[model samples]
Target: MPATPNSFSVLSHPSLDQSGGGTLSSPVTRPVPLVESTDLLRGSKTVGIMHNGSLYRLQATKLGKLILTK
Candidate 1:
């Protein structure tokens, strides 16, 4: 049997400066599936994120969109 791949990787290219200059920085790379927002949403209409001791709500709309509110 073929061995299953254990992990995934993603390659990101550096952005170039618009002032006729070369690349602004070196490329950045990371593992695949960096963030799965859906997983965090977890079939819920809202999720809470706390920042500076304040709670923020992220809501999923009927139009299949997201809205963040403090």
Candidate 2:
């Protein structure tokens, strides 16, 4: 990844890498930041996130998967 982001984020994990089709890899010098969905939602099924002048909705699906949309 670039030292600084140039956009193109549609929900990607920090620990995931483009190599090998997005596999998890640990950083040698620093730990990745992690945030639990429950903590973010605070018991709600949906949450609104503001990013780059756009409002996005993050929803928890019935199958327990997360979906983010603008």
Candidate 3:
């Protein structure tokens, strides 16, 4: 099973730094795209998701939790 963001947003968790004044209603600013569930896979902890003008690797744990691994 894959983890579904409880907040319907790929960038809503508190772990994300939301100092850009983006809200649940308006979650994107300056082209920050959302990460999808299909991007996550078992045994594959690294994912390429762009944010803050850089490519980030998002990791998924055995518990189906998505996290920024890099």
Candidate 4:
């Protein structure tokens, strides 16, 4: 089914305070592809819409940035 017009709002994160005691239990947003997986090539910057039609601005992560991938 198609989404109702303008029914979504951009996700938000609150500023963290000392000791990181601000909404730490909340889930972090993961960057998602807009059109297709091909739109975001591994190791390249990508600006596209998610499957849900939400706009996302993303860049591929560097090799050193990842600790593990499973």
Candidate 5:
């Protein structure tokens, strides 16, 4: 199902906090932006992403998998 406008997926990463003394019990929640595959592909099977000074290729395979290459 598609996500609702107010709904999203969240990921948590655990980190060590020396200030709290062995405090890795609580995870840190960070919001990651979600993008649909169709939106990225936009009517094509491949798209280019420019990061830093390099270009990366994101391609959708025939088997419905994605590949990223530098």
Candidate 6:
């Protein structure tokens, strides 16, 4: 079923802090898809993620698993 306005509002609203402080700010204001794993590994066994001027390797193993290495 599609998400209702009430449900969406609750999910997007701030929550009370359990630490007895105050309501915690909600960080997620909107939904966004960063990337899909299947899309990244499509037609390939390895993909790279660039960070801090470095390339990190994400590989699909023979056992049908994934590994990320710096």
Candidate No. with top TM-score: 5
Query: lDDT tens digits, residues 1-70, model 2?
Result: 5533333323356535545655546443443355778888899999999999999999999999999999
Give the candidate number with the greatest lDDT.
5
Q: What is the lDDT of residue 16 in candidate 4?
A: 33
The TM-scores, one per candidate, come to 0.49, 0.59, 0.37, 0.22, 0.63, 0.48
Q: All candidates: CA RMSD in angstroms?
A: 7.0, 10.4, 7.6, 12.1, 6.8, 8.1
Give the winner by lDDT: 2 or 6. 2
Inter-residue clash pairs, candidate 6: none
lDDT (Cα atoms) of all candidates against the true structure: 0.66, 0.71, 0.58, 0.42, 0.75, 0.68
State the displacement of the C-alpha of residue 25, model 2, in Å, after optimal TM-score superposition: 11
Question: What's the CA RMSD of model 3 in angstroms?
Answer: 7.6
What is candidate 4's CA lDDT for residue 46? 50
Worst 10 residues of 3 by lDDT: 6-15
State in Å the error of residue 20, model 6.
21
Name every residue pair that clashes in candidate 3.
none
**How far in Å is the alpha carbon of 14 misplaced in model 2?**
8.0
Give the candidate order by descending lDDT: 5, 2, 6, 1, 3, 4
Model 3 segments beyond 4 Å from truth?
A: 1-19, 22-35, 40-43
Candidate 6 overall lDDT versus native: 0.68
- Point out the worst 10-residue segment of candidate 4 by lDDT: 61-70
Clashes of each: 0, 0, 0, 2, 0, 0
Per-residue lDDT tens digits for candidate 1, residues 1-70, read 5533544443443333333445645443534344455876998889999989999998889998888999
